[model samples]
Target: MAERYGVVPTRRQRLPLVLGVLVSLVLLAWLLWAAWSHSTPAVAGGLTSYDVVSSHQVRVVVDVSRQDGDPVTCTVSAQAEDHVVVGEDDVTFPAGPARTVQTTMTLRTEREATSVAVTDCRAGSGGPGARAPGR
Candidate 1:
């Protein structure tokens, strides 16, 4: 032999490297899937304003963003000064051809409320994709 360039890796020595590569590939695939699944939500909304109409009524204005034509249901709740839930209602609407919609809901409460909000929103008339609360 003239001059050996470099020693070839033996099968035994390369086994761990191959196994590590396989394990890393598997982990990377799993991470990609997890990230993709949670990248976007179906429904989201927020309370724009609220008005205390009377001792037993509240008017709430909200802005909702969602996929077009996806029927979404949201829960609006009225709370008293001590953060007690004094009224609640389920409001459902379709985004139609728009991605955002502004709505107003009037709730009759059992007592006076200091604040009103959209607590949760979900996609589809068939239930929901996922619940995003406190939006």
Candidate 2:
């Protein structure tokens, strides 16, 4: 191998290095901004509590936070002991002058469910996954 210990990089070599560094910085900044925006999303939801009311029903309380004017829909599900969905449905929070909402609803199940939870929540029934809704 040739010794490169005393060799100075030419302008051509330094140009590519500088360009690569600039491109890397820009890409990193964009990535950070994207992550920060997504972390705070447009809406978020969580399940505060649930009740196995009967052999065919489960009552769940969902708490959601979002922009005051945009209506959001959340999917809630009841699962059997085997982790199979016994009941699932979409709950739409109507647009109003509130950023946070706590809703309680009962899901009629095919059989007794071992657990109930809010699966996914979004601004509209469109995107495959917006970010969050339910924890």
Candidate 3:
């Protein structure tokens, strides 16, 4: 191996290093701004009410919000005592206003659901429908 002491890199070598750092900085800045601008309150509130309709079913109510009148889709999940997912459903929110909305969703479980909650909510153009297992 050849060893050199107190060697300084030439301008040609340093140019690519400096340019790479500058490019990385610009990319990071753009990502930050894009995230900040597109970010919106996904879940406005938690489960408003949860009713155990039966041993294999649950009725859950949640409050969701968005920035426009576009419809929103939410994933409602039910968990058992062991925190295992027993059931899940995707319910759509109709377009109305850019404000908080109270949505009721029904989930059918294979066993029993000890707790239910809205996992995710997002705004988009879609119609109201139910996506549940064995439906």
Which one is best on lDDT? 2
Q: Is 1 or 3 the stronger prediction by lDDT?
A: 1
Q: How many clashes does each candidate structure show, in the order listed?
A: 0, 1, 0
Per-residue alpha-carbon lDDT of model 1 for 53-132, expressed as tens digits?
99999878878788566877888889999999999877777548878877777788999999888888778653443223
Worst 10 residues of 1 by lDDT: 126-135
The sequence of per-residue lDDT tens digits that candidate 2 reaches over residues 1-135 is 237566677998799899999999999999999999988879998888999999898888988898756878888889999999999877777677799988888778999999888888788643443223232
Identify the runs in model 3 with alpha carbons over 4 angstroms from their true place.
Answer: 1-14, 34-45, 125-135
In terms of lDDT, the poorest run of 10 residues in model 2 is 126-135
Candidate 2 deviation (Cα RMSD): 5.6
lDDT of 3 at 129: 61
lDDT of 2 at 32: 99
- Give the higher-lDDT candidate: 1 or 2: 2
Which segments of candidate 2 are over 4 A away from where they belong? 1-10, 125-135
